[model samples]
Target: MTDPISIVSTAMAEDTLRINTIGNNVSNVSSVGFKAQTLSSKGDVHSDLINNSDGRLLRTNRKLDLALQGTGFFVVDNNGQQLLSRNGSFSVNESGQLVTSNGKFLVQGRSGPINVGIDSFSIDSKGVIWVGDREVDRLLIKQPNDSMLLATAGNYSSASSREVKDGYVVYQGALESSNVDVAGEMVQLMAAQKHFSLMQRYFLLYDGLMKNGINQIGKSK
Candidate 1:
């Protein structure tokens, strides 16, 4: 059988990780396209993170803002690396190429990186970019077959080679709100903290009992 101390220590460690993940979720409640993560344990390991819920769409009324109405991610090119994201708040760079709001990455299109070149354009529901009456390019959207393959970083995510074409509608002038429920996360955080405290108290009690037993044996000798 596993030692009592080892069992309690493992449970305490799990509680600590749970509290941290809940805190992170609460902090990102207002973040755009942020997904709420939950910790799951597999066998004796307690570090499996999963996020599969979709957030609510918020209307920003800003022309460059975009939101996905279904399961999909807009592909962005950072240097040569492709990153998937749902935060569609974009801006044009000096070269007239559409990029993220921070101008760090270029938005990918069907043909490649799209350059509007100082021309006014609009994105339609089907992810098609239109300049006046001319069709420029279609946005490249993809989704992984297994959401577990995605590794999230802020509003962006990445997968190795499991991404496939996804059919999701795009809404211009909108953004996806974070899926985190602050109140629920706070409740979970408090519970995890209480569990950790209880485990610590049990550890102290066990240590004290062991010390008493050792002292009694010494006295007898």
Candidate 2:
């Protein structure tokens, strides 16, 4: 059996981690395509936590501003490394390449970076990119088989087992809002702090009781 101090100590540690995650969510409340993380447990034992959820789509009415309407991610080229993101807010660079908010180039058709020379561009519901009267390239949108494979890396998420999704729909002139619920995260933050404090008090009380009992035994001897 576990000691009272041990139980409370473990609980306090878990509570601290949970509180930090909640704080992160609160901080990113206004960030586009931000997914709220969650801590999960088994019975009375707290274990792994993960953040991966669909965010609500918000209209920005800007042409380059894009959002996924279904299951898919807009691929980006950060330097030479490929990254995935749900944040479709994109802009053209000086070289005319489509880039994400973080300055990563947007991966387009033929698995290459896109460079539409003109500022005038429009994306249809099918993820096709059109400039003037010609279709330059189609946007590279992919989907992962599992949500667990998606993990936060810098300003975006990395995925495994990714496949180009042809059945996905892209929404032009919009962006996906962060899924973090500000009120809910605030409530969770308060509750976690309360639990941590209560656990600390319990641990202190247990330690005091043990100390008193030890001193009494020593005096009797």
The lDDT leader among the candidates is 1
Error of 1 at 218 (Å): 1.4
C-alpha lDDT (0 to 100) for residue 203 of candidate 1: 98
Worst 10 residues of 1 by lDDT: 146-155
Query: Each candidate's lDDT (Cα)?
Result: 0.80, 0.74
lDDT: worst 10-residue window of model 2: 146-155
**TM-score, one value per model:** 0.90, 0.85
Q: What lDDT tens digits, residue by residue, belong to model 2 across residues 20-110?
A: 7788777878888776778776767653344556678898999889887666677777666666677788888788888876564655544
lDDT of 1 by residue, 46-74 (tens): 65364646788899999889898676778
In the predicted model 1, the residue pairs found to clash are none
